[model samples]
Target: MIKFAFLIALVAVAVPSPAAAQGASGFSVVNQTGLNMTNLTIRRFGTQGWKALGNAPSPGGRGSVQFSDPDCAFDIQATLEGVGTVVWNGVNLCEVKTVILNRNASGAIWVDYE
Candidate 1:
């Protein structure tokens, strides 16, 4: 009986907590647009409030956001230097590790999920 109890305790110690099992809960943004990015923010999908992600990457650079919430779906918004603000809606961070921001020949902003 003592051996069984000891084995159970060892297993419990080896098992990771719920938060640790979840791993990292955020994605990195790759700035491919020629313009600098600023005022980056993220929020849960269908939510009204936005949480600032801070320190957006410059053109041809990358930035990462680490969120505490366990939700996998989120909306991202950023303002491009000398350009208007842009938003990428309903992005699933769980599936997408990298998001690339780009601009078309017509100067319209777009996003690519990777």
Candidate 2:
């Protein structure tokens, strides 16, 4: 009985806490496009009213921004200055720790996950 109790105690000690068990709840956006990005906003999956990046109207090339997303899932939308917009639907932010916005071979906006 004592051996069993000791084994249970060891197992309990090995268990991870809630905070430690939590996955990635934040993300960073990397602007690889040569032009600035406008109206960069992100919202919880299926939720309304996208939250803007900041006061800036547009972000320049190679610029990056980080934001908190406790829910770990989101829908991102942004526009390229003087160009069309780029939208990422149903993104799992936890699985994608970083998002890189660039241009594809066809000259269209491409979204990459890192």
Best by lDDT: 1
C-alpha lDDT values of all predictions:
0.79, 0.68
lDDT of 1 by residue, 1-102 (tens): 999999999999999787555633667888887887889898888998998987999989998867666676677888887777888787767656788877
Summed backbone clashes in each candidate are 0, 0
Instruction: Tell me the tens digit of each residue's lDDT in model 2 across 67-114.
Output: 654566677787876776777777666656677766654666667788
| Top candidate by TM-score | 1
Total clashes for model 1: 0
TM-score of each: 0.69, 0.59
TM-score of 1: 0.69
- TM-score quality measure for candidate 2: 0.59
**At residue 39, what lDDT does model 1 achieve?**
91
